[model samples]
Target: MTKDIHLYTASTMNGWKPVIFLEEAGVEYDLTHIDFAKKQHKHPEYLQLNPNGRIPTIVDRSNNDFVVFESGAILWYLAEKYQKFLPQKPDERSVTLQWLMFQMGGIGPMMGQAMYFQRIAAKQGEENLFATDRYVQESRRLMEVLNARLAKSRFLACGEYTIADMATYPWARAFYWAKVQVEDLQHLNRWFDEIDARKATQRALTIPKPFWAFFGKGNVEVQERENADRFKSDVISRSNI
Candidate 1:
């Protein structure tokens, strides 16, 4: 198939969301690495594609070169265009969107803040225990909500896996990076492990290559610190969270 979808992304959680959807859908797409360190995303040309100047923007050349920004929006767009992942029924579709919104408005932001406060903030000598604790606590609470939902449902939206699962799994898998524990949340762990075991998810995670891939044989701590520093520079410096 022709690679018409152009994905400009890095190896962040949000970036992986749509890629996983694309891979699972068996869609061919080209990739452009948006280098945060080089400030490529801030260029005027890139800004035209995404006013927010964020990673994980997509240009659908097949659709009149249409552009989609925001990770959740990208997932929804792909699911709708392909008629997969998202249910056709109104009630099921609404429930899927609800969980997708939960991840967008709750899990992503809270865990992102938890990551900043727990890892990057201390490294920058601007550590605030209050902020760290607050986000971590909130993240845990959100995890519990997810766990409760997963305890009853096979997936986040319905019996079958949907875009909601695709949107949330990447963030949940990185819980440790956010300083939130999941060992106690059996349902959450079950849900996470099942998603993690998928072949498409494993493949999508390496798009543009993950941060640790550059380190190879380097010291683990050095690699982690560098990754955290990049996260701070790319995300924390730009937004309030």
Candidate 2:
């Protein structure tokens, strides 16, 4: 018997990672879109499920007890529990973990800050160009690392598509989706194109479209406006000036 997995996610890169993995692994799961507009992720109910108040949380309906959060942890759980899309060899497994950690620690956060400064920062015009360039350069360097790694191997680890690929693809894809130039990273571009061609990735892109539509054509603009407003309100509340 197949178990039911309940996935709570938004359409952001991190959120899409597990959705794509679940589809690619042919796992049976139900998706629930956590609307970022209304701050659904921070709601009392969701906090009970994930104290961090983040999306991409999952519940195992089979055992009616298992709960998991964080995209990396989710990938690890699905791979271990299903025993699919993960290498059995200890060394390859360790390498896979390395790339996944690289994505989480290096690429994701840097790109996130890049997006913030480019799209949402209130005093962004006054911000140091060096700071902006710093993040952009770091993101580019990480892409170079991935490109060089991919040139030697078909995937980030083990020379085969695995959870490591699933973990990194979404964030790397974000560079393109955000219209960031990556023409120089040829190998990474090739790998990105390969993942984009997958049926599962295509399907994951369309999941919960209606939920995203509420924020407009793309949630990026809407999210920026909301964040800006929130920041302004916070400034006013904190300062007696």
Candidate 3:
């Protein structure tokens, strides 16, 4: 099987995870932007590749066009396929999976909700101060967890850079946008700086274009207008199912 892959992704944190793995693994892959604004993710053709209709699904052409969805699962799949970021020793492998799960279950959801409340709901004038503060606090607490972990170890798991770090870095880097400060989390800050300086991360952040930087800098008013209609349509469509 060849290393050829086709990635359908966007510029969101979850979307960047697998791309970071692919870049670090030095694998050949083509990318197609999953345009949320256009609702292309819900298209039947794309839905077949990922029944959940989420961004960052990958089709492994080398392995008989095997399809993988969910960002964490994609990372695991690639790691096993190439024997790259995953550890071989059983104990270290367990440690890697543990931290990967920590990001999947803890960091991603909390920070994502923080982003929604701060950047979306609040800005849309549907501000829920309680919800915003709740998520932001939880997100900061998770950062503290990572900060403390890093104080003892260089990487998140396996005593080396692993998929766990790849899975978490995108979300961690966006802590500012989530309104969850990492400035006080000195160890976490140091970890972020190291990953941010990597050449693979530099290239990974650009796959499908950088959000919160270039393409994401588009007019907020127009995006809000479009998103309102798109979300309403999505709700109606889901209700029928």
> Best-fitting candidate, measured by TM-score?
1
> Per model, how many backbone clashes are there?
0, 0, 0
CA lDDT of every candidate: 0.86, 0.77, 0.84
- lDDT for model 2, please: 0.77
Identify the runs in model 3 with alpha carbons over 4 angstroms from their true place. 1-3, 213-241
Question: How well does each candidate superpose onto the true structure, as a TM-score?
Answer: 0.92, 0.85, 0.88
Query: Which of 1 and 3 is ahead in lDDT?
Result: 1
lDDT of 1 by residue, 70-132 (tens): 999999999988899999999999999999999999999999898777667677667789989
lDDT of 1: 0.86
Q: Which is the winner by lDDT between candidate 2 and candidate 3?
A: 3
As a whole number from 0 to 100, the lDDT of residue 152 in candidate 1 is: 98
Quick one: ranking by lDDT, best first? 1, 3, 2
User: After best superposition, candidate 3 residue 240: deviation in angstroms?
Assistant: 17
Task: Look at candidate 2 and give me any clashing residue pairs.
Answer: none
The runs of at least 3 residues in candidate 2 whose Cα sits more than 4 Å from the true structure, single-residue gaps closed, are 1-3, 122-128, 177-180, 210-241
TM-score (C-alpha, index-matched) for candidate 3: 0.88
